[model samples]
Each structure stands twice: as structure tokens, then as C-alpha cells.
Target: MIQVLFVVLFGAVAIWFAYKVFTTASMMRSALALLFSMTAVGAMFLALQAEFLGVLQIMMMASEMVVMALFMIMYMMNPGGLAAMEMTHQKRLSIAVAVVAGLLAVGAALFGGWPLATEAVAAPAGQTRELGLEIMERSMLVFETAGVTILVAMIATTALAIRRPA
Candidate 1:
């Protein structure tokens, strides 16, 4: 019963924030709405006992939204989106695509032959610890490469900022 309530709550929040993301005039607000939506999705994952996926969703969205905001600030004339502006393009086509996509999703959900787990599975002990160990063991090199790439990008950005206009 409590799980059902939480699922409903998180699902509603996700939908609300997703709507806010598209409807808001402010770019920052839109980005924040997207962040909130993603966080709510993470909450739903948690409610469904997908701890690793929940944490990953929240963390990934947080970083991505921060980077998106930074780029908006760097490139946009009105980073705050205080001035009213039409953010969307191709409204009619987008609506058409959205309608079709929504219908397809609903159809699949109704018609898909998904197998239900008959037996309750035991939860793993120290799931987080195990996940951390697995990630470190398999993806240490990937993380290192990503870190180096970020460092290089930061250096390049600093160099460009400091360069004098000829």
C-alpha cells in the first residue's frame, strides 16, 4: 500500500516537472524542471527497489543539468530566460510526433507480453558495496579517461577565455 502511494506520488511529480520543462519560458527554469523530473524518476526507481539505477539517474541528471546551465550561461544572451521568448520550434510537427509516440507507447504497454516474476527474490546484502566494487573493477579506465577529458576541456576553455582578441 505504501509502495503504491509512493509510486503514484513520484510518477505525478515526474509528469508535472516534465511538463514544466517544456512549458517554462526560462531556460534555467526549464533545466531545473528537467532535473526535478529526472530526480522524481530516480525516486520511482527507488520505490521499485532499483537502488543502483535510482542513484545513477539522480547523479547523472544532476551533473548533466549543471553542465547544460553552464553552457546556456556561456552562450545565450539571456541565460536566465527572464525575457519572454519562444523556446520551441516546429510546434505542429512536434505535436504530431508526440501524439503518435504516445499512442505507440500506450499500445505497447497494453499489448506487450511481459513475464511476471512468480517467486520473490532475496535482496542482495551490501548491494551498494557490491555495485561500487564491480564498477571500480570494470570501469576504472573509463572513469580515468573521462576525468582526463574533462580536465583538458577545462584547460582549453580557460585558455580561450584568457586569450586576447587580436
Candidate 2:
């Protein structure tokens, strides 16, 4: 089915980003990887017919993530991009073992005979359009407020990250 294929593709991309996040050596790399992973999640939301949520994920999380990464990079004194620096103690073997164990556990749960929720309901036709209308009508203020907050946070972070003359 198309849905299954979309889910699989999106999941594979997310997993690749997760691998980059886990294996990267520094804050900027992890943040950049996390940004990609979040974008993949937003894409998955779109595939699942959650358009509002998908847009929110991109507008709120992805932009903030990039801003945070830039702030970190700007503030770092290393002069290098920080990707080459170690952010934590090396424990590759332990991390690999833990990742394998977690994967097995997730696989077991996924394959387990979990019953579908009978109470789940489908949205009516034109549901996304209706939802968008409602948001525009009633929740526009809240949405605008969130955007302002994101802008303020980005400005504050930039201000904080800038270096002062010695």
C-alpha cells in the first residue's frame, strides 16, 4: 500500500538521521542531525494526513533547531565548526550494545498482537480544509503568538552568542 511505503521511507530517513545524531562528536553536528530528524518526522505527519501538525512541526521545531545550532556554533570558541570536538566520553561498545537491545525490544513490541483501537474515528471529507479554516478563525492569535515567541527567542539567542571585544 502507498501508506505503508510512505511510512517505511520516512522511518528509514528518520533512522538515518538518528544514527547521525548518535554518532556525531559535537553539539553542532548533533543539533544539525536532530534538525533533519525533526523534519523527517514532520514529513511523516504529512504522510499521515496531519497537515496542521506537520506545518507546526516545521514552523516551530525545525526553525528553532536551526537557530539553536547556529547559536551554539557562534558561541563556541573552538574556531573550528565544533564537529571535530568530542562532546562526551567515548563508549562506542556500550552504546552499540544498548542500541541493539533497544531495537530488539521495539521489534518485539511492534510484532506483538496489539489490538487496534475500536474507538478511533476517521475525519470527515474536507477535514483538513475545515481544520485550517477553524484555526484561521479562532486560533490565529495563538499561532501568531507562537511565531513571535520563536522570533524573540532567536534574537535573544543571537545576542547571547555574540562575542564581546576583550
lDDT of 2 by residue, 58-134 (tens): 67878899888888777766534444665556588888988899999999998988987766434644666777777
Residue 150 C-alpha lDDT in model 1: 98
Point to the candidate with the largest lDDT.
1
lDDT of 2: 0.81
Model 2: how far is 154 from its true place, Å?
A: 13
Q: Tens digits of per-residue lDDT for model 1 on 1-166?
A: 9999999999999999999988877778878889899999999998887787798899998999989877776887776777777666999999999999999999999999889889754364567776677668988888889999999999999998896978
Question: Residue 11: error of model 2 in Å?
Answer: 0.9
Please give the CA lDDT of all the candidate structures.
Answer: 0.87, 0.81
Where does candidate 1 stray beyond 4 Å?
124-166
Candidate 2 segments whose C-alpha is farther than 4 A from its true place: 25-27, 77-84, 90-97, 104-108, 117-166
Task: Provide the global lDDT of candidate 1 against the true structure.
Answer: 0.87
